[model samples]
Target: MKLYPIEAGNFKLDGGAMFGVVPKSIWNRTNPADANNMIDLTARCLLIENGDRLILIDTGMGTKQSEKFFSYYYQWGDHSLDRSLKKYGFHRDDITDVFMTHLHFDHCGGSVQWNKDRTGYEPAFKNAIFWTNEAHWEWATKPNEREKASFLTENLLPMKESGQLRFITRNENNFIEKSELDFGILFVDGHTDKQMLPHITYQNKTLVFVADLLPTAGHIPLPYVMGYDTRPLLTLSEKAQFLETAVKNDYYLFMEHDAHNQICTLQTTEKGVRLKEIHTFDHLFD
Candidate 1:
């Protein structure tokens, strides 16, 4: 089995929102904010190649939103989903499974795109099965008022409409009942309801796709949870348990939203579990 890091694109979000109630004085040190108080973020996806299956975990927010809609997020960067796929001698059609960690726009927007006529939406990966859990599918489709803005209909629905959507009826631990995908899934609810963090065993190491649960290295601390989460207090407890497990199991965290660092390791520190080292995807196995 082999893994590749796919660069989707970069965007910015209010540092305050990203850091939640954490003081700017603290988080700004690791994730420095710009003059506008916006912090850099990336929609970094993972491509897994195990035998005949080429599974993609999370497609970054696609380029379908209007300029006005994008202006709010401060979209910036030259990286794109299609170009990134080409970098690895792959194409969207090569993807047999598109595993979504969650249905947030930044994470799954690339699942659909405009048809040739631009009359309606279509599945971005024409031949791939879009994978998401039943609980999250319902949560995103009938989004609550707080998360409605992030759950756009265009980013969803089309995959289901295209008859390519498949639901993973997971256990309480979020493991796919009959998962064919070659990875262990750790179900987390701190960031969102039933966010499946893929635990890929590669080269004698477990590389976990740390989705919004730990957006960046700066979020290693237990208190540095995102305000976008519906249950902040629950996030604290979940993070603590996850971090402990990560440290105990010697897992390599594949950060999905960290712009500068692609992967990180945690070390037990006096304060708490802190970042031990940072590595690029190429250097992870080396």
Candidate 2:
């Protein structure tokens, strides 16, 4: 199997919001913030090639939102979803499966696009079966006030409308459970409800698609949680448990929102879990 680090684009978010309850004096050391307290983050998605399936993990924020909506995030960079796929000798239609970690705009917005005439929305990858949990699909479709802003209807509904939406409902422990193609999972609910973290076994190594659970290296600590999460206290418990597991397993965390580092492994220190190594995707196997 081959894996590709697809760059979608870069955007900024309030550092304080990203690092909830954590003091700026601590998080700012690694994730430096601007005068407005926003920090640049990368919308780094992953693509996997196994057997006849060409699967994409998540698409970054698409370019369909209005300028006023996008101005809030301060979008920047040229790495688009289509451009990244073309670089890998493929196109959007070539994707056989799209495994969205959740329905957040930054993670799933690129899955749908506005039609040419602006008449309606359409699945970005028309031929692919978009994968999301049934519970998550419902939660996003009728999102709460706190999350409604992040779950735009245009970014969703298109997959179902196009008859390409499917849910992975094999079992509850989809996290520790092994997927059909020998892939593993780590289901985390701290960041959101049931965010599946795919653990791909490659060349005697494990590459974990860490969604918002541990967004960036700076979020390695148990306390560095995001304010966007509905359950912050639960987040702390979940993070502590996973950090130990990631350290014991020497798992390579594929960060979705870190701008500088692509992947890293954790080491169990006397204080707690700290970053052991920061390396690129190819470097891990090279």
Name the top TM-score candidate: 1
Per-residue lDDT of model 1, residues 183-261, tens digit only? 7787788777888888888899989998999999999999999999989998899889989989999999999999999
lDDT, candidate 1, at 248: 98
Off by over 4 Å in 2: 174-176, 180-182
Quantify all predictions' global Cα lDDT against the true fold. 0.91, 0.88
lDDT of 2 by residue, 99-205 (tens): 89899999999999888898989988888989888888888898888888888888888889899999876575546567644577667776777778889988888
Model 1 steric clash pairs? none
Worst ten-residue run, lDDT, model 2? 172-181
Best by lDDT: 1
* Cα lDDT for residue 103, candidate 1: 95
